[model samples]
Target chain A: MEVNHISKSFGSKHVLSDINLTFEDNKIYGLLGRNGAGKSTLLSIMTNRNFADNGEVKIDSEDVSDNDSKLGLMYLMSEVNLYADGWKLTQIMKDSESLYGGFDHQLADHLIQEFGLDVNQKFGKLSTGYNSIFKLILALCLPVRFVLLDEPVLGLDANHRELFYSELIQSYSDNPRTFIISTHLIEEVANIISDVIVLDQGRVILNQPVEDVLAKTHSVVGPQKDVEQYTKGLNVIGHDMMGTIRANYVYGDLDDRILPDTVQLSNFDLQKLFIFLTNQYEGSGKNENK
Target chain B: MEVNHISKSFGSKHVLSDINLTFEDNKIYGLLGRNGAGKSTLLSIMTNRNFADNGEVKIDSEDVSDNDSKLGLMYLMSEVNLYADGWKLTQIMKDSESLYGGFDHQLADHLIQEFGLDVNQKFGKLSTGYNSIFKLILALCLPVRFVLLDEPVLGLDANHRELFYSELIQSYSDNPRTFIISTHLIEEVANIISDVIVLDQGRVILNQPVEDVLAKTHSVVGPQKDVEQYTKGLNVIGHDMMGTIRANYVYGDLDDRILPDTVQLSNFDLQKLFIFLTNQYEGSGKNENK
Candidate 1:
């Protein structure tokens, strides 16, 4: 899917400002950013659920303006509600089969059994775990080539979240399709992503391969004097203090001389990277590309 | 807080079965499990919001069966309500102050500015990000000794979630309090926690210092043969396949042989550890302690 330079606003408040991004086929891309950074808006425009003030979205280099089948190229922000209130689980499977061409009833049925979801119960009253199981079933069962999941693991406990991750990765691999996963739990999803696109203040801040992103961001903890000297040229993410010992999460290669065995080093967790990058932009009042 | 052989059941469903836990003072513990793993059930029982089928909870060795105030604890489980729809932000603050005994008006006012919340807006109508901001503000304003947060980052964007973590760690440093944070986002919160507890099947599975847990867990990824041989006799977390190359995460030492230059290793991410530990428990149908 190709998203041309798009802009959106609500009256005078700019939500998405001149955004351009593309999702290559058959790979998972992590759509990341701080809250209110216009990720949802950008996603909305790409899926054609909401109109962009300017710009266009293309699938196979053809516009997705007014075509239902073409719109099938994408699915965005999926969560629970596999069956609404008073609806049976099997009814949802039927509805999905009717809506999406790629809907696989066999897969859905198989998943329902695997997850221990009762097909007879109304969907609204399912437990939180069951709700996530239902969403996972729908996401995996969808016929769409581009599946966009926004916070799909919200109500899920740790076990279900991991299940969803492994299942999503496995299904995406088997199907060979583009998957855009939007999540706040960056580090949790970091290792699974092939690519990542970070948005800040309604614009793309960083987009690169996952390993490169992780490799470039790191942190160091040690005595304040030694850490301060070693971190002179490094990008400091943040630091903490305890009496005299200070742990500074700096973002650069360490001068090993200053960082001995007593000091510790860790790759900056993606969530912190998100925070620091967003804070940098917000402080400078300038977007990365701007 | 010490919970002594607590049990809770609803109708015929046993939510919590003979659970006993001792949450230490001045430590941040991750109360982890899958959905419906009885985390919330156990928390509710400890807080007196829900009566246990049988058992007792003590604070500082004093029985908390009939006393709630002296516990000096504050619990925030996802969204309670800021009442923002019709009420002003100021009005919402006033309302929350009355409900929490340790409410600090000065701190509340300071956090309102820190989060950039609009005081004129109605409580129920704030944007999702601002709603999270409000909850964070409420959490910080309270002067409780022990704060329990259950999935506090529920609807937050990455930026807000990051800010919450930094401020939370700082708060713990300044106040020296016990924080029991329950969330599925493990890696994000790992840095802030001093200790870890992984729960599965309504029981504590892995509980120890974070450092101790990480010592036995590491991922060795490379060629399938090397990976297989290296992981022999160790607890395998999970493995992924990319053609002939398989990357396996294992729990145990990696010092048998010098790892090949092609093989990459990393300290076990907490999220992975949580998933592997819990999934292992569920699959084996046995508790580690048992």
Candidate 2:
């Protein structure tokens, strides 16, 4: 799946403007941005459920909007309304079996039982976590080449969320499908995302491999004086100054000799990195919510 | 604030059974659990909005239900009718002032501008992030002893989340209050939490300081053979074997002599830790959404 030169707006408001990016093969790509950055709009357009004012979205180098084969290539926005509130979840699975070619009935059943979602209960009666599990099962079991999840685990508990990530990785390994996930919880998904496409005010700001992204973004913690001096020439991403303990994120390489042994170093906090980058580029002038 | 042997059941299903916990003053507490673990239900009971089938929730050594000052405690859920749709937010603020004492007018005004929330706009017309900011502002501006935030950053983008945390800390410093925040994005808020309480099946499983939890939980990476042997005596929190690097979340202070310099050591993933801990107590059955 891929999109190029996409520009969309509502009235005078430029929600998404001049966006160009590609979602390659079977890798997990993060579709991230601030509210009103047009993430939903862009996904809506790609899925052909909504149309874009301009730009092209293609699946397997073919226009997805008009092709039925490619139509089966995607699924998006999980607001489970299978027929009616009276419908049982098992009946919903039967419907799924008819819609998608790669539907795995056995796997779906196993997952249903795993999530403790009662097969006998009506879909409406299930708890929110069970509801999220239901969506996750269908998405994983159904045979789709490209899957898009937007806030998929809204109501999930800690246990269910863990299950979601494990199943997601398993699904990818077993089926080799492309997943485009949009989420506010960056740290949880950071380990899984092969690539990240950061959107700012409806424009694609950064699109790169997650490893490279992390390698370029580094955080160091040590005595306040050492941290400040070491980060002077580098692109200082963020700084948390609490008394003498100053933890900072810098976008640059470090020489071994200059790196002090007393300083404790760790990988960047993706959540903090995301926040600082978005703010540094778009956070200024805005009255600090802090 | 504290609860003694609370239990609430709906019809035949048991929502919460034999639950007892305490919330300390002038500190941040995390109320964590799966979606249906009665987190909301428990919060409702403590706030005096709902009645528990058994047990008592106390506020300041008195039953929560009888105290008029309980109104000072703010409970903000993701989905609720804070104000009627057509009413302007400014009017709602005026109304809020009457409902709660010690409301800060200055902070409210600053929050409105900081988050780009239009005070004159109708309440329901606002975007999700904007709505979150507005509600957050109202909760923080209230001169209250206790504040409860349920998925507070619902529609907020990455940048706004950091801002929200900063604002939260700043407010707490200005006026010491007890905060109980329930969220699934554990890693994002892990640093800010003074104490964490993990609930599963409506029971508290692991509750401790952040440093204590993280210290006892560290990841060991190497060949699966050595990794498994090295972690035999330790409580295994999580493990991931991918080709060459086999990582395990070992619970113990690992001896460096046994680990050797060749094996790569990594910090524990908190999100993964929450998942594993909950799964151990309960199960990781998939939520089978068809």
Recovered share of real interface contacts in candidate 2: 0.76
Per-model C-alpha lDDT, please?
0.73, 0.77
Candidate 1 chain B worst ten-residue window by lDDT: B281-290
lDDT of 1 by residue, A173-245 (tens): 6678888888877877888888989988888888888877778776777787877776778777666666677
**Per-residue lDDT of model 1, residues B1-290, tens digit only:** 78898887789888777787888888888887777678777776677777998989888888776686744465555555625468787776676667665577776665565566788887778876787777777767777666777777777777667657867776677778778888877777888888887767777777788888888777778888888877777777776667667677777665567677777888767777787776643444222211
**Which RMSD does model 2 reach against the true structure?**
4.6
Fnat, 2 decimals, each candidate: 0.79, 0.76
Question: Which pairs clash in model 1?
Answer: A34-B159, A102-A143, B83-B124, B84-B122, B84-B123, B84-B124, B84-B125, B85-B123, B85-B124
TM-scores, all candidates, are: 0.79, 0.84
Q: Distance from true position, residue B284, model 1, in Å?
A: 8.2
- Give a tens-digit lDDT track for model 2, residues B1-290: 88899998899888888888888888898877766667888877777777899998787777877677764565555456658899998888888888885679887877666677778889989887888888898889977778888888877877788778877887788788888898877877887888888777778887887778788777888877787777777877666657666777776676654775556777775666787777743322222221
Q: A98-138 in candidate 2: lDDT tens per residue?
A: 87765787778667766767788887887666776777788
